[model samples]
Target chain A: MTSPAGRRKHGRPTISDVAALAGVSAGAVSKVFNGTGRISPPTAERVREAARKLNWTPNPAAIALRTSRAQAIGLVLTSSSPVPEVGAANVGLISGIESLLSPREYGLLLNVFLTGHHDESAFYRSLAERQRMDGVILTNSVVGDTRFDLMRDLGVPAVLVGTPWKPGVVDYIDADPPSAGIPETVDHLVGLGHRDVAFVSGPAGFVLPNIRREAFTARLAHHGLTPHSVSSVGYSPAAAAEETSRLLDVAAPPTAILYGTDTMAIAGMRTIQSRGLRVPEDVSVVGFEGLEVGEWVDPQLTTVQRFAFQRGRAAAAKLLGLLGETIEEDVPLEKPVLIVRQSTAPPRSR
Target chain B: MTSPAGRRKHGRPTISDVAALAGVSAGAVSKVFNGTGRISPPTAERVREAARKLNWTPNPAAIALRTSRAQAIGLVLTSSSPVPEVGAANVGLISGIESLLSPREYGLLLNVFLTGHHDESAFYRSLAERQRMDGVILTNSVVGDTRFDLMRDLGVPAVLVGTPWKPGVVDYIDADPPSAGIPETVDHLVGLGHRDVAFVSGPAGFVLPNIRREAFTARLAHHGLTPHSVSSVGYSPAAAAEETSRLLDVAAPPTAILYGTDTMAIAGMRTIQSRGLRVPEDVSVVGFEGLEVGEWVDPQLTTVQRFAFQRGRAAAAKLLGLLGETIEEDVPLEKPVLIVRQSTAPPRSR
Candidate 1:
């Protein structure tokens, strides 16, 4: 086989070269090629043989010009924070997308689109003009997201990875109900003999926080139980720790606390210990969103974890489906699983 | 300003339109475009106006066929495991590079290059031929790195983000000496009246592990103090925690232990408490990397931190320097700083 290094200063083998070797006109070769029409099978085979002898391959750029398909997809983290916890879903979403795209020779272009005044519409338009990405997965979608309408009007293919702000406009895949793990989390805590369980929720602007907060409250009420406190705070680790301490100071302190996220629960664990308290013995702690750190830390946390990898895979498959790829068999998305470890136990006997 | 919604269905203005507007032949218009050959001042102004009126921009694919600049940079995380700790530096590096590139309209393409079987050389060659990235940043550069020669011969600009396996082959930047944070950690421990200090290092395959290990041992020796133990192990949290427990079991237990990463230190802290020991009173723990969680935990960890954001910015600036961008004033990299918090104290009085 002719090697790229051995090739002369002459650029890629031209259609004329293939035509001359095959004893055919350039017009005949063009017909046999992917241009407009097809030539006789015998002439096409001869042209293919001549092309193979010269180690020539059709240029994908020229093909892209005719087809208008970039064969690439984009992923964006819709937050400005440099902190990793903010876009934790991106951790698995990336690998899942890579697993499928790399095999099919698709380029995955990723970037962060900071919320507010970033001109996301212009960015998508630029991508289309430059042939950067054919479709995108928008992470951290908020309620009443104008991006849905913007993408729709622009005629760009999109698959949102969060609960959709507007229904029927874009394809979306989130752990269904946005609170699939919360009811089970409450059940596990109540089963562990905890009555006064407080729910510390994340920021209110996003959907998951509200979903987890309401689910926790409603689930407890369903069991004829009352929460000691419900604190809503920003996505700061210190703020969560402070709120956990405040709950501890209340007259009716919760025997167990279920935090809206693993980030908050991990930080709260430290606050409980610093205040001369034990993990399961003094107050049980449960975290939503299973993080690997939860397993590594002391008294491994029992938390609710959405299968971020499977979610990413499902989202990517849906995008391929939009691109006219036939889905042979549907891969079922695994339900949210609760991981119980050393972080929870029966409430201490008075 | 015409809105995108109201724009005509006519495709991106063709070269024929621009040529007609300038009253010049298509061949002449191609010559005047991209400034390969200069045109007369009056003619150039007329062409520019015509192009502006037609809403025509230089097609990147056609330009790429002439000059081989893709105006894009590539980054790779060379690990197979989907662990957050593995790609920690990417969080800041993405933003730092984006801050500089977005205004210039450059694309940043990132993907993982798995180690062992994946051919890094073939990857670079394909990128050049496909116009994916004109340059790349190799994040997990290893000892005897061959990628330097591959990129150099392939004539692709590359910046290695770690200590060069062999110097002078590639432009590289790491926290100067890669041991910038080790000495201060020992100094703080000694100042707190801890005589017997132990060192727990990371996996030996990577440069940072060996760098931290040697620095920890050398610094302790410089104080005329012999270390209680110097253990080198894999990058597992459980292994590091187990090492800490073994160190505690010794007849002469270390008063303070310096861990290789914030990850290992967090796990070790739990082991101390699980064994019914106080943080500073029984055995003080200091982490190498100053992570945010370290600050949120019970006794905030006393550790040394490399400003990852500034390092990322510096690495990017160096890469741009390689790309022939004139950097007016030098941006000196910040040195590693030691942060003393509640994790360390004087040894308990016997």
Candidate 2:
């Protein structure tokens, strides 16, 4: 039994061999293989099958010369605000994008940029300078995003994962931040007989928080019960815990607390437990982002199920759509359905 | 205020404009920008300054052509088994790899293979045929991964995220699976007065499980306890719950449960809680894979902490090393330190 490694004695088959077998020039073979330069499908199939048989591989450069397409999509995120845990989201997004790109034989090139940072500006400058990608997908968009302007100005077709301030200028898909969504979450809490509610807002000026805060305040007005308080904290779970602790310790504390993200929700739950306070029994909690970890957290959190994976898939489809591909415009954005678990219930005195 | 959307008032500045100011040939300007076909350092500096003055945005394709290096790294993962949660680890790994690749001006090209019960032979064939990448990195290597062999045969510089069966044939960086480190964890348990410890394994026959099973059994003997039982479960948190319930139903249930993964540990904790059992007091639970969620879980799971990020960094470093960049061989193994949190404690009256 000869090892496959040793048996490959002829060395890697090249395009020249395929050309010889097909009785064509190397350029013709490359054009056929790359499906460019006007080869019939049948003829291209024959060349491909012959190449497969001979183990002939096409040099990507030669293919690049024939097609003039990079055959790649670029994934962009802020380098400074590294979301390590949000990897699942990234993965889900990538998976969704891959589902779209793979069939078309398009590859994905992930590019990370540091926003408002000097060192990372060079990185962004470098990415814009290197025209190796067909389109770019920007996740983690912020107000006044220079990346959006830069990508557009460069004539690079791009899409945003989150809704941008100026919607029409660039294509975007976003989880409804606060206005239409958080009211439903707060309303659900109100339905559960919770009078006073507190909110944990992650990074005040961030799009989601700004939206959530306004929604919470407006919803409180509708209920004729003002929120106990709205607290600001860093994005870290630890920061959520400290903020949650402060909110919980105040006089006339709320019976329900809402969190901007799932990680914060989980922290709030633990903080509640540390005080011998039972979830839903003593206080209720609602979280956003619907993270997978939220399911396993004790008293499995009641959360608005934001479909990041679906959104990622939608973003990929939209980018492809910009490339003249078939796709639906109405990507699902039904308000995050609240997954009521052990986390929310009637107020203690109800 | 013109929306940056209007076609740029002026066309992108060209190398000619830069060359006219730098007083160098277009080729010299190109070579200088590409860091290839280089001019003298002073001349290169002059070209850069002049290009900056003209606000020259070198054509990406032209630069790519002049440099010749693709400035791309192909990251290949099996599309079929991609765990969405593992996206975080993938993110960490990519971020680590990107830290190196980005500095060197290399792009990360992600390839996911999802054939849906179809043979992956075509995927491999296409990859072998394509040469858009300077090198490739294969993550989450499974048993009988033919990629290593294919990469070796192609003579493309490559690195593996998980250890291959033939270790010396390819460079790889991976966590020393808990099986290899089980003795230490088990010893810690024994030292803490634990007996009748039950071992929960990940889906059997995996590389991590293969090592863990042996180490767990051997470690039990070393501690003078016959490792009587081993339970294997699927990788999901739900599987952990089911397995934990079964383990606890026994007439002589173990006093301690060692979970193979953090997800399993959380599941097992839920299982115990559902049975009206208290963790540590009823049956101590220890989990592997010290993710951030572990801290948020009540009883703040006492588990082995493997530096998933550091391991990612090390893998990137090894690839850099293989690329003839200087890196130390004494790359540290991120030991799994047992975080003695609220989850593990001595049995009451075992």
Candidate 3:
């Protein structure tokens, strides 16, 4: 009889070796290992014992090919900037998603493409065609996003990380209404005796920005005040500076300004101070997204905080459930809230 | 007499079908597609023609299994924070790496593990045993790092993103010296009449903080001046605040302070203001790692800037070259430079 070590010296043990040692057919051993084609507990134990003795483990690549499971999740981002923004919210989202996925031994395949430089549609098609991921988490949904139709046509499972433009189009995880804190923000500014308040929003056609802009408008209307001015700009520092300058240069410039994101608000604050005006004294600034950097800035920004990390975890969990993973418990998402800091105060008399 | 559509109605065409149509063996068809096991150009053309006609594309999973090429890169980050700092440098690094890999159709597998929460060694072992990635990019090298030996034992290819502690252990890409900007930083402060200069560095054992501190010490000695104080702390806002306070409470506080990172520097600025002292007036401040958020701070941070994005691209390119991929061109790495902003100025008379 060949010793186990002597057998291993020839080559790595195969399924047949385990089956031969266990006095079973290769089919039985395969079934026992794959948990497919029912077998008796005693026979399974015998096969397992033989395999453990032989020191053989199934190849993951072979298993993936046979089972048609990639055991990975896809996340593709599109950015206009050469270096995509690594904002606190984005980092929190990635960390939250990994928090759950890592335990399950699933990998996250991340890709970022510069807008207009790569054909995103082709990439999605290749991913589906190659079956590279079991499912994907989509973010930054735009109004009338055709990616929904593309995913559906490709028969790919997907979950959106932002507000869904069309209800029932797909499952989504977002800050419940995303405008939950808008009313509070408006109330705070209005209570501060500011009649002229303006909103600087993200570019049009994005679902989140559009939703936020409408929320700001409705909240102002509820207070019986009309917006002094509203402008939409790209989510870039340059754009933020230019728009803030335009707002400040206006005759009878607004006493307070609300920005779509904390990053934009921070830039606006810089622009305000560079022009020799003080925060809250000349123009009170409010921002959305309670990023940690907000506190580091002078006059800590007063903004609405969204729990991106929790949302990311929820989205991943929902995707896992769709992929037939047993979810231990449903993760709850927190609502956005208004965090008042030194950046906002009563506006000075014009 | 079956049409291509009629044949497709049965199932997706396989390599056998292409071989049969091209009057060649399956091995020939595979070799032609994989660019392995040399075949005549005309024979390859014939095989390609048959595959195109049948609309048969080899399954990527099957190819990966047979070729043992995962065609992916791994990046694992260890952070003490729940949500790791998503600083501009980190974001740029990821973006830069993806800029090169995405075009080559290689996926990036990114994992973040919280320190002490997960067994990082076990993770690396699994990554190697499972062949989940062809190579990995490692960052945040420390003194006497054992990971280098582990990678060697596991036969895993790796590229370090920071300075390698031991030379010839693995290929590395870092800001040349990382301390290249220190001399200029010291010069700027000394020129501004800052005699009592101190350096607040990242925690001990981190290679970067150690190198920067050594550079600071040597430069001060060159100027015939001694450091007022040198304290090592964790790279956290809380740590920065406490250390700054401790330094201030001393009998004779340093007139100028240089921090290991921009985040810590920003926090120090806030601490200085909270104590009723103004920046660059009572005490001048400087920081390393010129993060974009630095510009958004009250007195825009003056610090040394490292091009993390470019380094990321260089690291990825090097890893690809190690994995036997044809690197088109070498990506040039930029040295660190001191960016003078509003934070640094002549100190006030004691």
Candidate 4:
């Protein structure tokens, strides 16, 4: 079989072209490269000479089909990234996945999820069943999803970038949970003599919003304090500011506030200042997610930082292992730490 | 010419399958679809009958070759977008491009520009020279670039997302500049009764940083005032805050500042407030690019906004035209406006 000329015009010569030049079958050329069957010395010499003359190497995709046993894997990204937190992290995740796939000769296909479409899961099924990708990594997965079930039915290996809910037979790497730092956070705020603390979280669908809400309330209960929580938070700075304004205007306003994400925390702090209240003075502020922008402001944001890049590496490592590769050393992520910045201080003695 | 069954195992039926089933050439089957050639009406009936049985259409890539005579296009992305601010814009651009390609049956490949790579242009040249793509869209093109020159030399169709530097021959659509409201911006700042105004621009390689610097200086000159411009800038929040800090501490600190991007303006505002200064009370601030986060802050952000999605649509429209599609109604972006929020108020009298 002779491969098309256009694909080989400026790229490495194809096995078919080498076979054609050597007066042999394409399978013979492939076998010579794979070293599977014993060939007459003269035929092997002819194939080798033709490959050398063309500076030819086997196509990575073709090799992946034969050896790696998979052609491609996909990373599905939805259009709506509510919190402005995932851009850099997504880059890190993709780069890490590439690090594994490049060496194994597998291709990565990016499948973007768009709204106003019929069904997002259908896209994944088509990719795996029709396009025949080995498996896929789904980002921004929701609370109840059909995509996971579809992958399961198709027997395609799947990995979720966020926590898998009620997933008995699925593999996943959850987003850094604020649950891990609630204790330190509560201790620090209480040590500063705060009794009434309010919490602002992202939208119900995102960041497993309840994870932070439950953790914050439980931790507050543990401290024998009143829990004032705000759920209906968007990824916008305006949402946080609006909630902060309402919280401060209450008859019994809290002495401190905790935001589910760094962007929200920073915006909340700005809103507090705009209302003429001092951070940590009138209302101490805390953030989840270790965003770099948290440090760019004055009174650096006292936030619980999540290592996105390292988490990405972890996801890629997990996916590679599922692909049947012997596991190498895994990337070490700094345990979620309470990054104390200038934003937190004792409330005014009351 | 029936397509192999394995190739049709999962995908929707393809033209090759019809040929295989009908025991005819793929070209003969295509002729049945186009209503061309001098095949007997009975043979044509057989081809049509086979197609109906399988339910297949011609692949657009194959059709594009015979009809549009155009090759595929790629969009190159850089991995420096760490914040949510840039993510939305990038998505807008990609989706706009997708709007055009989906109907034409061309695939969009994303080529990420990684750091630590010695030659950026070599990547594009190799893609084109090796016949990987017919052309590519270079986002964030730098000054004195070799990519444009290489494309010109190779006779490849190219589109740029940003302004093409020294681009004498390349086809490009420059980003929507805040041309309609610069005078209003200047007037508002000057009306605030402040003479000392500073401009912090983006990197020298981007947005032709000199364009903003020179425009800002000349605009000040136009208002019969001297200009203080920071020409060396990185697309980072820390860099903006540091510059804002140095400017605020100067012997004759400016009463107002202009930032090249919204992220910078937001960071600068935070830095100013961190120093125990009020936003509009201490200094007025302005930003270019209409980022949604601007509305989420206290006092809101007084900045200019860009129509990234619409501009992307325009870029796609231009490339589609190059791909042999007739240009229709062009995407019209609303004129750039200088938004005046509470961040800009009359400077406190010295």
Candidate 5:
């Protein structure tokens, strides 16, 4: 049979041809580029050389059709409110995923699903008709989500950034916002001789809210100390300042406070200084997100370094795995490290 | 003459029917909905009402083919070295544009043309041939860009977020970076008793660099006080801090600093404080970009409030204006206001 205009008379280069040229198996050739399957380093190199020499370009669409995938991945986030923290996080995640997908010839379709932002039916239609993307990476997953259900019913593969209560055999990469990072933070503070600590948390009812609070309480108990109080505030520096001022007014307030985000921590520290209180002496502050602002916030805040970019990379990897690429289980959860700066110290001996 | 669907075929709403129902011309209906013509409010409402009643759906493909315009818009941005500031700015711009396009049933295609980030040719080919977006939005335009040249050669319409010096008649919507915002900031600082002010700018050789520096010099002249110095640094908090530190160590330091962005202002403040100096009392600082963080930074930044949302809206309007709709030149140059907060004051009575 004659080949297409761009192909040789024997038809376009098949996996086998590429494999033979590379001195590797068809599977090894695929895995070499995909970062999966078993292949020696030399064999992998050979496969890449062969493919390049043969001018073989993989058809993503045909592969999608054959593999029953869309060959494109969806990144679902809300751009409606567009808070700075979430907005910055989204940027980091997108860039991270792009780092992986750019080389693989995979396309990312950003599907922002915000109620009241657009005609919901149009977005639904795009997903229902399989017109937009193949697999999806769901960020900020709310419990018992209809979007997740719809994605599942459509048999479209998806990976969640946050844990879903009933993800139902769906793949996911979750951050241990409560126990993993918080306990380590508490231990670090204790090591710094902090006996009285306060907890500042995000708004209540979300998964992170509950998880972080419990972790705070449990970690406090382990350290033979009860938190001065748990303060919950809206996500903003102004809100954090208002809440922190209340805690600072108490008769026996904590010497250190752990903040949910760098924004809040920055505000809290400023508020303490406004009251003429010193950080790490009269009061110490710890923050999450390791925002660059944390360093500029007077006594550079001591924070746990959570890899937002790596998390994004992991999310992309999980979605890719769901698309028939085998990924190893027991994948190492990115451990957050405490970057001790000027913000932490021993409580005053008095 | 019979229509393409045949004479006296079943009643299906056409552009002509929308025109008739709306009590306006067919061209007006096309302009209002297809983003081509400018129609009055009431007349546009009538056309929309008719289209809804008749359940008219314009064939996007046919429209694209006939007009040689893709019924979509391409947003071109860099993906390799993703600048969070630019990324955030683009997000605002994209979301605002989405608001404008969704009502008109136009699809948005986001393309990140990071050199070596992806298979760029395939993406360009698909965007040109398959995706077929009508026009493109090029953000952060560099001088003498090849992207603009290619779009022009392809006969596609384009609207730039920043000014373009490429050969053809290119249209753009840029914040009055030099004259409007940064100059006003200097004027405000000089008015507030800061005689020796410094300018901290983003990378040299960029479009805004020379414009902003000249504006600072001109504004200083207007105030009868020459600036101590102007320094160019990379677009990051760390870089801003390092540059600010150098400026502060000079023999005769500036009493105040004008930063290119809110993040830079925050960093500059920290650099001053690290030397046991206080903001306003020792060295006041001002910044650009009315980002949410501007309000939270300690001694909350006095800066120019460039309405990013409005900028996005204006860019979209300009794109619509280019699509055969007449829009006045004054509509695009919406001036930004100076948001004077607590960051500026009379130089310390030292």
Candidate 6:
């Protein structure tokens, strides 16, 4: 619609209309909405009433431009897998982060990249230079990750969601020790008389999987034993299945196998069953990351429960703190715990 | 870093620096990156080389402001469940959409909200008025949805990802007939000698589940039979389990049950087994939205394969088309198909 003067008609009212109705300058109306600038309490109330009547809300873009804050956070997921494998932990993390960010009216700028297919370095630089996000939450830290330095150089505040490869490299929130439940898993298997245990780790370069592998190795050494085998593969069902088949083909196959994630464990179980072996009775299986899908499988997955959702929330809160927002400091997340389920048991006496 | 002129020195060069190096105006450099304005091929190459030497990339925000295009798409997920149940389908959809958007240098602005906990209507309005997205992709269309009208009034282009409650109200990409594959499911069950079939549907207000329930009803009516029972519940494992337990308690319990999602079917199977009943043999089960998780569960679930990832990509392509981006027109998605697995069989004779 257009007015007689050829001005385009906005069916809904705008700030200028609100200001006119409230008998204040447009800037004064903006001050009320932005919660900045000096304005009398009564004048603010009048401006609010006018806004309510006109149904006018400040445009976020304009606010962003005025305040030099995008009012958004960035989350970039870089996976080498063909299919984007956003695990249940990642889902939980996203939900938890949204829980906090939603109330604050902050949007999440999510970018998914299949490692080699995209220029991740350029993406980060663009985000920082464009001022698209006030801060970013980084996940899946790798050994010698260059993102931390990149963010620092670009002057973008960031918080890492997993263990940093090097301590003090960045502000991070991690499951303390980064291998919290691995020792418990080892003790559980050893207590059940499992001497030959194997581990199927996530891709080799990831810090989390590396920590987990080392923990499994060190814990087994404590039992006066060593890993029967270790396979490093991408996080995918095919990878898990192939690794499981290879392990089963060994002369003295492992009595128990630990997987980097619950999804991997489920796939491994299917492989074992397809080979005509029973889980736990023939070969015990364990997983990391307590995903709900673990429970629906025939033999519920025995897993190391990391509070991914809470960690996501904590990471967001930490980022908000860095942005100078006052937040209630929550108790730091507890270490991951082992949840023993039907997938694991004493190995059969051969 | 600071220069002698009291100007902040960016360690990395800026567009102006690149322009200076190339002996061109900053606007010329912006034009080269944005691919606009007339410039000789050789000059463009020289500017690119200067940018390479300076390691400069155009800031997205500046480009956005100059062009009035945000270069992002908005996806709002509204759910009533306590936990954000971003099912495998949603995950697939996200991955599919990202597969296209990432290469175009576009970002996805994702927002998750628990229905009543957040004002969804206001959020949509904000997204439209703030120019935060070039367009939006809407999912989970409810009966008598107001979003369609709102988007229309706001003049924001949108593509609905699922069946529209009222056809022709919005541009949509959906399984043709919306009830595709239901007839096959009914035939598969009926041919397996299951006369008393019950259906468990997702939350009642959504268009997809309502269409599915109607399809089941119409198919059974053709067989001169009625549903043993029908239960409408939220799409959650707890809801599915509780409904399954209730269904089993009926005097004339269903010989076969159909579920709205793979996750729900998995939960239902667990419930049946918890009652000491074997799947297929005791009660046949079928699920929809053929998620990969179904394959890992014992007695792998039979399901209606909806091709969620393809649908997601289609939705994105359609949105891109609406945004005036030249995208390859993909063949329309085929009707959903039935995948027979171990979960379904002839019900045991009473």
Predicted model with the maximum DockQ: 6
Per-model DockQ against the true two-chain complex: 0.15, 0.38, 0.38, 0.10, 0.10, 0.47
Misplaced by over 4 Å in model 3 are: A1-3, A14-58, A82-88, A327-330, B15-58, B82-88, B327-330
For model 2, what is the error of residue A62's alpha carbon versus the real structure, in angstroms, after optimal superposition?
2.8
**Order of models, best DockQ first:** 6, 3, 2, 1, 4, 5
lDDT of 4 by residue, A55-142 (tens): 5656433443354333456667664442112243454566666555543434455555554342454344334423335677877655
Model 6: residues >4 Å from true position, as ranges? A1-16, A20-62, A329-332, B1-17, B20-28, B31-62, B329-332
- For model 3, the docking class works out as acceptable
Candidate 5's error at A283, in angstroms?
5.4
Cα displacement (angstroms), candidate 5, residue B73, comes to 4.3
Q: Which lDDT tens digits does candidate 4 get at residues B1-350?
A: 33455656778876678888888898897765543355676786677667656756454334433433323466776645432122435655666665555433343555655543324543444344334345677776676766777777656778887776674656787644624455567777888787888888877766556666666777778889886545457776778899999998878788888887777888899889889999889888898776666765555789876766666667777876775656565567566677787788888888
What's the CA error at residue B197 for candidate 5, in Å? 4.2
CAPRI quality level assigned to candidate 6 from its DockQ score: acceptable
**TM-score for chain B of each model, two decimals:** 0.79, 0.79, 0.87, 0.78, 0.73, 0.88
Tell me which of candidates 1 and 6 scores higher on lDDT. Answer: 6
Of 1 and 6, the candidate ahead on DockQ is: 6
Decoy 6 TM-score against native: 0.90
Worst 10 residues of 6 chain B by lDDT: B1-10
TM-scores, chain A, per candidate = 0.80, 0.82, 0.87, 0.77, 0.72, 0.88
Residues B69-105 of candidate 1: C-alpha lDDT, one tens digit per residue: 5456776666544332334435556666655555344
Query: Per-residue alpha-carbon lDDT of model 2 for B262-315, expressed as tens digits?
Result: 878888988898799998898888888677778877777888877666666677
The numbered model that scores best in TM-score is 6
What digit string (tens of lDDT, one per residue) describes model 3 on residues A147-191? 878788777789999878989888788876766788888999999
Using lDDT as the measure, the top candidate is: 6
Model 1: DockQ score: 0.15
Better of 2 and 5 by TM-score: 2
| Residues B169-246, model 3: lDDT tens digits | 878988767678888999999999999998988989998888888999999999999888888998777798899999
